[model samples]
Target chain A: MTPIVKPLIKTEALTKTYGSIIAVDNLDLEITEGEIFGFLGPNGAGKTTTCRILTTLTKPSSGHAFVSGFNVVEEPVKAKSGIGVVPQYLNVDGELSAYENLKLHGMLHGMEWGKMKMHIEKMLEFVQLSDRASSLVKTFSEGMKKRLMVARALLHEPKVLFLDEPTVGLDPQTRRNIWGIIRRINQERATIFLTTHYIEEAEVLCHRVGIIDYGRLIALDIPEQLLKRTGRFVVEMLDDDRSKARFFKNREDAGRFVASLDRDAIIRKSNLEDVFIKLTGRKVID
Target chain B: MVGTYAIFWREMVILRRRLIRVMASYAISPLLFLIAFGWGMGRSLQVEGMDYLTFMIPGLIALSSMSQTFSIAMDINISRFYWMTFEEFQTAPISSSSIVLGEVLSGMVRGMLASFIIFILAAAFGIRLNVNWALLLSVIFNTFMFASAAVITSMIVKSHADQASFNGFFIVPMSFLCGTFFPLSRFPEWAYLIAQVFPLTHASSCIRAAALGMDIPLISFLVMIIYSILFFLGAITCVKKASL
Candidate 1:
C-alpha cells in the first residue's frame, strides 16, 4: 500500500472577514514539502491575506491552518518559528546594520548566541553581503537591501519560507538575481511558498501555481499543464492601442487563425498571462 | 522572555548609534527650563517651604522621564510607517505580550537615561534633592504608564499627522498642567480635580514627594500601579490586533 504523506502546509476552509467584506473566503490549500508553490493573483486578490494568515500576522476568521504539523492560531509561536517570510515591502530596519538585523531576528527565533553568530555569518555570505554586513541598511541600494532581507529571513533556516511579491519594483537584473536565489534556496530542500502578480515570474519560478481570484482559488496545477490546458499558442491582432487575442491548441491551428485575420496580427507561444486571461476573461495585470 | 530580550537588545543597538545626539537632546530642554524658570522665579519665591528651583528640579525629573518615554511612540510610528521594521516583530516568533514588554522596557531605559541627565544638570547648578530608591521606582512607574500609552497611540494612529495632533491635544497639555511645572493646588478646585484624573499628575506628585523627603503616598502609588497594568494590557492588545 502507498503510504499517506502529510502536507507541510495545510489550510482547511480558511476564511477571513473585515466587517461586511470577506477578504479570504473559505480557502483550502495543501502544499507538499520541497516544492516551490506560487500563489498567483492580481492586486487585492487575497494572496497577501492568505500569506499573512499562514505567517501568523493575521488571524483567520474561522478555519484551521497548520504549518509543520502545528496549528497556526492555536500554536502561533511554534508555527511561526518553523517559517520565514520576506514581505512585499522592505521591512528591514534602516537604522540597523545587516548583521544587527539578523542577530535580532535570530534572537527572536530563540537561537543561542554561538549558534546565531555562526548562522548570521553563513547567511550574509550566502546573500553575498558579507562585506557590507556592518553597514547601516539605509545606505545600501535597493538590490542590496533586498539581498539583506533575504539573508535576514533565511538566518534561522526555517522549514517553510514565504516570499510575498519578492521581486516587485526591482530592476530586471535584480529580479533575476532574486529568482536565482529563490531557486538555490529551494534546491536546498526547503519548501517555498511565493506570491506574485507577475505571470512570467510565476511561470518561471513555481513548480506548481495556484491562481487566486476574488479571494478564491480558481486553478491549481503545474505551470506547463495550465498553459497546455489553456492553449499551446495564442494569435494576436492589434487595433489602435487595444489588442485582441485567440488561443489554439497547436501552432498550425494558431497560424491558420492569424492568416484569417484582416488586420495586422502575429502568432506567439502562449504564456501564463494568456492562460489567466482565458480563465478569467480579464488580464492578470488589469 | 527571550523574545522580549531580543527586542530590547535591538532597541539598544539602534539607540547606541545615536547615543550622543539622544543625550544632548535630553539635556537641552531641561537646561532651557532651568534657565527660564530658575532665574525667572528666584529663591525668594518659595513653593511649599522650598525655593522655586528646588521644587522645580524634581518636577523636571518627572517631566523628563515622562516625555522621554512617551516619545517611544514616534520611534514606533517611524518603524511602522516608513521603515516598516515593526512588521518584523509582528512576524517574529514572539508573543504579542512579549513584544509589548520589550518595547516598554526600552522606553523605561530611555526614560531613566533622560532622568539621569536631568540629575546631572541639577547637580551642576548646585541644587541637590533627596535621591532614593523611591525616586527610581516612581520614574519606572511613570515610564511604564506613558510607554504603554505610546504603544497604543502608535498602533492606532493611521498617519504621522494624526500622531502630531494627538501630541498637540494630549501630551502638550499634560506636560504643563499635570503638576509637572506647577502644583495642582494652583488651579481652581474643578481644574485640580480634572488634572488629578491624569496619570502624569500622580507620577509627578510621587516623584516630587520622594525627592522632597516627604511621606510616600501609597494612594498615588496604587493609582499609578493600576494605570501601568491597564496600559500594559492595552498595549499588548494594540499590537496583537494591528494589521496592514
Candidate 2:
C-alpha cells in the first residue's frame, strides 16, 4: 500500500473579485513537490492574481489555499516561510549595496546572522553577482538587477519559489541565462511555481503548464500534450484583410493544404500560442 | 524583535551613506534659529520669567523632534512609489505591527539625533538647561507620536503630489501655530482652542516644562500618551491595508 503524498501547493475553489469584475473564479489546482509548474496567461488574465494569492501577498475572497501544508489565510507566516516570490516589478533598494539588500532580507526573515551571511554569499555566487557584491544596485544594468532579485528571493532557501515573469524584459541571451538559473534551482529539488506570458518559456521550463484566460484555467497539461491536442502543424495565410490560422495533425497534411492555397502561406509547427487560440477560439495573445 | 532591528538597521545603513548631508540637516536649521533669535532680538527679550533663548531652546527641541521624526514619511514614500522596496517588508515573514514599530524606532533615532544637535547649539549660545529624565520622556513621546503619524500618512498617500499636499495642509500648519515659538497664552480664546487640538501643542508644552525645570503639566503628558498609542495602532492598520 502506498501512502498519500501531499502536494506542495493546493487551491480549492479559489475565487477573487474586485467590485463587478471577477479576477479569479473558482480555481482548483494541485502541484506536487519537486515539479516546475508554469501558469501562462496574457495581461489581465488572472495569472498575477493567482500568484499573489499563493505567495500570501493577497487573500482569496472565498476558498482555501495551502502552501507547504499550511493554510495561507490561517497561517500566513508559516506558509510564507516556505515560499519565495520574485515579483513582476524590480524592488531592490537602490540606496543599498547588493550585499546589504540581501542582508536586510535575511534579517527580516529572522535568519541567524552567521547562517544568513553564508547563504547570502552562496546566492550571490549562484546568480553570478559575487563580483559586484558591494556595488549599489542602482548602478547595475537591467539584467544584473534581475539577477540580484533572484539571489534575494533564494536567500532563505524557500521550499517553493514563485517567479512571476522572471524574464519579461530582457535580451534573448539574458533570458536564456535566467532559464539556466531556473533549471539549476529545480534540480536542487525546490518546487518552482512560474507565471509567464511567454509561451516558449513555459514550453522550455515547465513540467506542466496551466493556461488561464479571462480569469479561468482553460488548459492544464504537459506542453507537448497540449500542442498535440491542438494539432501539430499550422498553416497561416492571408484571408481577405486578416491572416487565418489552420491546424493540421501532420506536417504532410499541412503541406498538402498549403499547396492547394493560391495565396502566399507559411507552414510551422504548432506551439502553445496555437493551442491557446484553438482552446479559446480567439486570436493569439497580443 | 528581530524584524524591528532589521528595519532599523536598514535605515541606519542608508543614513550612514549620507552622513555629511544628514549632519548638516541637523545642525544648520537650529544654528540659524539660535543665531537669529539668541544673538538678535532674544539678546534683550524675556518671556515667561526666563531668558528668551532659554524659553526658545525647548520649543526648538520639540520642533526638531517632530519635523525630523515625521520626515520618515518621505523615506517611506520613496520606497513605496519609486523603488517599490516597501513590498520587501510586505512579502517578508514579519507582522505589520513589527514593521510599524521598526520604522517608528528608526524615526525616533533620527529625531533624537536632531535634538542632540539642538542641545549643542543651545550650549554654544550660553543657554544650557538641565537635561532630565522628564525631558527624555517628553522627546520620546513626541518622536513616537510623530513617527506613527508619518507611517500612517505615508501608507495613505497614493502619490508624491499627495504627500506634498499632506505636509502643506497638516504638518506645515501645526509647525507654525503649535506654540513652538510662543506660549498659548498669547493667543485669543478660540484661536488657542484650535491650536490646543494639535498634539504638537501638548508636545511643545511638555518638552518646554521638562527642559526649563518648571512645574510640568501632567495633563500634557497624558494627552501625548493617548495620541502616541492611537497613532501607533492607526499606523499598523494603514500598513496592513496598504499591503492588501
Candidate 3:
C-alpha cells in the first residue's frame, strides 16, 4: 500500500459555546496540504467563530484543533505563526500607510529589517497594490483595503491562510482580481482555507468545500462529487407559472434525454446555492 | 522586554503627535487650579496655620496626575474595544503582561512630567522646595501611586459610560475627601475615617508632608508603597484577562 500523507490542518470534535448558544458544535475536519478549502455558511452560522478558534483568538469549549500539527491551545504562538487570518471586518490600521501596515505585520511576527523589507515588497506586488503602498489605508477603496489585508496576512508567509469572506463587497473586477491572487497563492503550494457565501467563488476556486448550517457541517466533498451526490439531473426553469408548467410537462422527456445521452453525462443542474437552500432551508446571500 | 519596549515606543510616538494638547489639558489643569486657589482665596481663610497655596499645590499636582493617568487608560481601553485598533497589537506575539506594563510605564512618565511642571509653578510662587532629594522622590512615589490607582480603575471599566463616570464615582470623591482641594481636617471625624479607606489619602498625606519638608509617617509611606504594588498587580491582571 502507498503511504498516506498527514493533513496539514485538522480538528477533532472542535466546539465553542457562547453563553447558552453553541457557535461551533463538534466540528471534525481534515484539510490536506496545498488545497483551497471553502467553508460555506450563511451569516451567524459559526464560520467566524470556528476560524477564531483555529487562529487561537478564542479557546474552544471542548475538544481540540491543530495548525500545521501544533495544537491551537497548547502552542498558540506556533499555531498563530503557521496560520494567517484575514478577518471579515476591515481590521486594517487606517492611520497607517499600506507599506507601513505590512511592515508592522512583519514586525509583529518578529521579522526585522532585511527580510521584512523584502517580504513587504513582494507581498504588496503579489496583491497588485504596489503602486499604492505608501498611501494611508483610510484613503484606499474597499477593494484596495481587502487586498492590503491579504498582503498583510501573507507577510510572514504562513503555511495555512484563513480568509473569512475575502470578497464580501467589491466590484466584479476587483472580486475576480482577488480570485486570481488566491489562485496564484495556491499555485505556490500554500494551503488556503476561506469562508464565503459566494457559491460561484467556492465552485470555481475550492478543491473541496464544507457546507455549514446551525453550527453543524451538513456536507463536505469536492464540488463535482457533491453535485453527483445530489440526484444527477435537474430540469429547472424560471419560477414563473408558465415556466413551472413547462418544466413539469417536460420532466419525463428531459429524464429520458439524460438517460439516453452519454453515460458520463450526469446532467446535474443543482448549483451550490440550490444545494445550500435544500440543506438549510435558508437562502445563500448573493 | 523588547516587545514591551516596542509597545512603549509606539505609545510615545503617538503621544508625541498630541503632546501639545495633552500638556495643555493635563499639566496645565493643575497649574490653573493652583493659580485660582492661591491668588483667589489665599486671604479668605486660614488653612492649618500654613499658606493655603503650600498645602493645596501638592494635592492638585497629585490629583491632576491621577486623573490624567486614568483618562489615558480609559481612552486606550475604549479604543481597543470599540474602534478595535488594538487588535493589531493583541494579535501580535507580545504577551498580555507587556501590554499593561507599557501603559503603566507611560502613565508614570506622564505623571512625573505633570509633577515636575507643578513644582516649577510652585517655585515661581515662592513655595520653596526645602531642597530635599528624598522629599522629591517621595512626591514622585505618591504621584505614581495616584496614577497607578487610576490606571487600575480604568482597566476594570467595561464600557465607555464607565470610563466617563469614573470622574463622578472616583476622581471627584478622591479630590474632595483626600485633601486635593482642601484639608481633610475640615471634614467631620467620621468623614476623615471614610477618606482614609482610600489609598489616595495616604498618598496625598505622604506627598504633602514631604513637600513642606516635614517628616512623613513610616506607616503612610508603607501604605502608599503597598497601594502602588496592589494597584499595579490589579491593573496587569485586568488587562491580561481582557479580550481585544
Candidate 4:
C-alpha cells in the first residue's frame, strides 16, 4: 500500500485582524508536497496577508500555521529557512546589481561564499539573466526584474516557494516566459503556493485552485473539476456594456440557451473564471 | 550575525556607488558655515583661550555627526517605501534585532565618516585642535544616540514627507540650539535648562572640552550613554512593531 504523505504546508483556523477589521478570516488549508496550489482572489481579498503569515513576515492573530513541518509562529526561523517568498511588488534593491542582490539574499540565508558563487551563476542562467547579472536592477526592464526576483528567491534552494502575483504587470510574451520558468521550477518537485488575480494563469499552472473572497475561501478543487462542477459549457450574453454568463451541462444545452436569448451570445467551454463568477456573482479581476 | 552583515553590506555597496555625492553633501554646508561664521565674524574673537575657528571645530564635529546620523532615516525610508528592500529582510530568516543592529551600525559608520569629512574641511581652512581618545569616545556615543533615534523615527513615520518634516522640526532645531554654534553660557537660565535636555548639548560640550585638552565631564558622558541606551531600546521596539 502507498503511504499517505503529510502536507508540506498547513493552516488551521488561521486569522489576521487589523484593529476592528479581519483581513484573513478563519482559514484552513493543506498543500501537499510537490503540488502547485493557486490562491485566486481579487484585490483586498487577503491573499497577500495569508502569504505573509506563512512566510513569517506577519503573525497570525489566532490558530496555527505550519511550513515544512515547522510552526510559523513557534519556529519562524526554521520555517523561513525552508520557504522562499516572491512578494507582489518588486522588492529587489534598485541600487545594487542583480548579482549583488542575489548575493545579499544568499548571505542572509547563511550561505558560504564558495557555494553561493556557483549557486548564483546557476540561478542567473536558469532565469536567463546571465549576461545582465552585473547591471543595476533599476536599469532592467520589468520582465528582467521579475526574473531576477525569481532567481533571488530560489538562491537558497528552498523546498517551498510562495509567489504573490509574480507576473502582475508584464507583456504577454514576458508573462509566457515567466510561466515557462515557473513550470521548470515546479518540475524539480518544489511545492509552489502562488497567488494571482489572473484567471488564465491559475487555470494553466495550478494543480489545485482556491477561490477566496471577503477573506474566506469559496471554492477549492482541481481546475478541470472546478469547471466541471459549474458545467461543461458557458453561454455568455453580451448587452450594450454588460455581460452575463450561464452554465450548461453540455454544448447542445449551451447552444439552446444561446438560441433562446434574443441578444448577442457566445457559447464556449467553461473555464475557472466561469466557476469563480458563478460562485461570487462578480468577475475575479473586477 | 550573517544577516546583520548582509544588511550592512548592502548599505556599504550603495554608499560606495554614491561616494562622491555623499562627500559633497557632508562637506559643502559645513565649509560654508566655517567661512561665513568662523572666518568672517569670529576672525578676531576668542572663546575661552582659543581662536573661534578652533572652538567651532569640535562643535561642528558634533553637529555634523548628529545630522549625518539622522540622515540614515531618509535612507531607511527610501528602502521601506520606494525600493521595498526592507521587505527582503522581513521575509528572510533574520531576526528583528539583527535588522536594528545592522541599521544602527551602518548609521554610526556614516556619522563617523561625516565627522572625518568635517575634520578635513577644518584642516583645509588651517584650523587645528587637540584630538584624543576622549573626543573620539564622545563622538561615538553621540553617533550611537542619534543613529538609534533615526531608526525609531524611520519606523514611526508614514511617508517621505513625514520624515522630512521630522527633520525640519526636530533635527534642525537641535543642530542650532545644542551649543554647536554659540556657547550655552550665552543663553538665559531657562533656555540653558532646555538646551541641557537635548543629548547633543552634552555631546557638544564633552567633545569641545576634550578637543581643548580639558578633562571630559563624567556627567556629559554618562548622560549621552543613557540616551543611547534609551534610543536603542526605542528603536528595537519600533522595528518589531513595524515588522508586524
Q: For model 4, what is the alpha-carbon lDDT of residue A92?
A: 82
Fnat for every candidate: 0.75, 0.75, 0.19, 0.81
Q: Lowest summed-lDDT stretch of 10 residues in model 2 chain A? A: A277-286
TM-score on alpha carbons, each prediction: 0.96, 0.96, 0.85, 0.96
**Tens-digit lDDT string for candidate 1 (B181-214):** 8778889999999998999889999999998888
Clash-forming residue pairs, model 1: none
Q: Please, what are the lDDT tens digits per residue for candidate 2 over residues A148-199?
A: 9998998988899999999988999989999999999999888999999998
Q: Which stretches of candidate 4 lie over 4 Å from their true place?
A: A1-4, A238-242, A255-265
Candidate 3 or 2, higher lDDT: 2
**Stretches of candidate 1 exceeding 4 Å from the true structure:** A19-21, A238-242, A259-264
Q: Is the docking of candidate 1 incorrect, acceptable, medium or high quality?
A: medium
**DockQ of candidate 4, scored on C-alphas against the true complex (2 decimals):** 0.68
User: Model 3: which docking level applies?
Assistant: acceptable
Candidates 2 and 3 compared: the better one by TM-score is: 2
How far out, in Å, is residue A131 in model 4?
0.7
Model 4: pairs clashing at backbone N, Cα or C within 3 Å? none
Worst lDDT 10-window in candidate 4 chain B: B42-51
